[model samples]
Target: MQTRTNTFIAITSLFIALGCNQHKESVEPKNGGATEKTIEPTNKVVLSSDIVWQKLNPARGDQSPQAGTIWGNRNGKVATGFLAKFTDGFSSPPHIHNVTYRAVVLKGTIHNDDPKAEHMWMTPGSFWTQPQGEAHITSAKGDENIAYVEIDHGPYLVKPTDKAFDNGERPINIDASNVVWLNYEKSEWLAKDSKAEISFLWKSHTDDALQGVFVKLPKRFNGKLHSTGNIFHAVVVQGGLDYTLPQTNEIKALDIGSYFTSSDRALHSIANTSDKETILYIRTNGSLNIDNK
Candidate 1:
């Protein structure tokens, strides 16, 4: 009887020890490893218009050109953004950028001329893409200063090319009014109930690494809580929206001219709570993949 009792106790203790070990493993950050806290990198940032205005400075190495960086270090290999303001009647001699760039005209008129090709006069809300190694000249018309937002990868340097330019290809320029808006409800990537509209601006010819879109959300519209494994830089072109950062549980009211950047794979949502439609100029680095949840 004593042997039977000893056996029962031993079996019970063995089970208890096994259960404790399993519990410890389950609570640990890694499988069968010691418990550790995971630290996530800060991947979200907001840049209000006021902040951008304060950061405005003359373009580095350029002769007195007003500009401000929105996000990412322009000197780094990652994608970067800048808000450039041109003086009235400003014109540039034929030049080229080392890296391709996409631009959205925020205010005033911009006249783009390629000596070897046709000229395009772009007004506010116009979108254009300047391919790398393509030489072109830019000029600002009208009495008011012209402003535009430029997004690109690598350093922002202006290389002066010879007056002799190539007529091989022309820059892609699209007026905002001429762009066709596609309903977000019909898109396979968006939530079925979403009431937003999107106007695609430009997609890189080489790959999906660079792309730009103009999104318009009606009042009281709620976007899907989506995540893309690409860094997104967005600027509020008109109206306002309430942006929610799911991980931090923080809400921010993005007014016109407000800018924000989301780290790769960060989950977030936007809602147009105002009475007017909210327009956002969104640019992404890397391919944009939408997660339903």
Candidate 2:
């Protein structure tokens, strides 16, 4: 891949380093005298402040929306998750992306559609997707507009409408009001008795078995989110949560655009101490076991 822009900003080291080291679990002795360091996976949190912000398209470069990566490299040829912040009243000219992507609104409102489409402002908690090579425009009109954008594979690029071509995948624009919500009892990932709600967003067409979901917590909810999978990416989309820090056990308030992740099997401690419910966008290939604290 000769594309330099997509590989430009990568914090591969940071994602592995941002973790909080909780107590290591079940030490297994190594065989044949190999050094035994089989520690259990630890939880990591990337607060809004910890994000390294950069331009989404350095080529377009004209005040392009600022992107803060949560995991993977937006400019690389691998899966990526990043937060894109748009200026108020900002709108892009008709363009197409080199790869498909999914997004969740975290702050303010956004309008993404074909040039001739009606203006449909997607507010917080809304979900949308733009297929690769599709011609479209993105607009932000809120005082502060932010969204969590993700791609399965990237060097996510911005090309002129001339590059548009359908790959047999259609676009989906779902506003917050149109989204369906299910209580915990109806979800396999949440505790049945909890007030938490969950919504399905998407599932991978690849063998990675990746999927996207939105989980909502009731006010002041305290619980542990146990994840058992090879990959997990969680982002704060609405309200806030008190997350335990990796280095120190200090509780940090994670607002919109903040992120956290886990590997293999790990438990993440979270508390929705706010008076309102908090919603999180989770990209994972595992099962979520919500346990009350």
Candidate 3:
């Protein structure tokens, strides 16, 4: 009887040990290494006007080409932002972009014409969108050269839209001055003390992930430090600001045409140290959120 009892005890212990071993193996990381770090969806970047201006290249690879790009790499599957410069009298035949794009006229004047629609003239601060495969022509007006910032998902390609008229869809062209400016006093996403106005330029119909807006901050405006879990890009359209990056305690002085990007969940703040009102053109790839801190 004692020998039989010993065998039974040993068998039960072995089964328990085997079960624990199986559990351990199941709980172990599948990669067979330390858990991989989660990739944050945001990207932090800053591009000054001087730097981008110097990076401009002839769009057609000629000195007198109608269009030029400041910075863009459309060969990859990524989002691209480019500053396009069009010379006076610059024009393009009816063409369509492989990807939908948004543009903010930064300088001079731009005239967009569609064979199936009316002509629309866009000036500085004007914002517009061209849907993918929409046919249109663009030209620079007046003696000044036209420069606009274009943002889109890559790879950016131009194709002749000889049959776009058959689709019967109208393009979007809006002058920023005509858009109603809403006060940020009651905005839930901003600090209660923020004294600014905002004009929404574009919002994606597919999702709230993509949007554009123009913010007007009064002189000496200062806002509390806030963090957002969305990728943000801002350009100084008129005045200057001192932007702070909380993580590194670094401050950047952004002047006119200076651009910067904040990664998702980055802690940052912006202040208009200048005496003049500051206008900022901001774009985001996701919904904006404000941190309580």
> Of the candidates shown, which would achieve the greatest lDDT relative to the real structure?
2
In terms of lDDT, which candidate is stronger, 2 or 3? 2
User: Candidate 1: where are CA atoms >4 Å away?
Assistant: 1-43, 50-63, 115-120, 142-152, 163-169, 285-293
Among all windows of 10 consecutive residues in model 2, the one with the lowest summed lDDT is 26-35
lDDT of the structure predicted as candidate 1:
0.58
How do all models score by TM-score?
Answer: 0.69, 0.83, 0.69
Candidate 2 structure, TM-score to reference: 0.83
- Rank candidates by lDDT, best first: 2, 1, 3
Q: In candidate 3, which residue ranges exceed 4 Å CA deviation? A: 1-45, 50-72, 115-119, 142-152, 163-169, 225-227, 285-293
Q: Per-residue lDDT for 1-293 in model 2, tens only?
A: 01121221242232222111110221112221101221454668888989988876676675678998889998789999988999888889999999999998888999888877877788998888888988889999878899999998989888999878889887777777766666654554555587887776676778535677788888989987766566889999889999985446778789888888877566677999879989999887766666577
* Residue clash pairs of candidate 1: none
Assess candidate 2 and give its lDDT: 0.75
Quote model 1's TM-score.
Answer: 0.69
Model 2 misplaced regions, further than 4 Å: 1-39, 57-62, 245-248
**Highest TM-score, which number?**
2
Clashes of each: 0, 4, 0
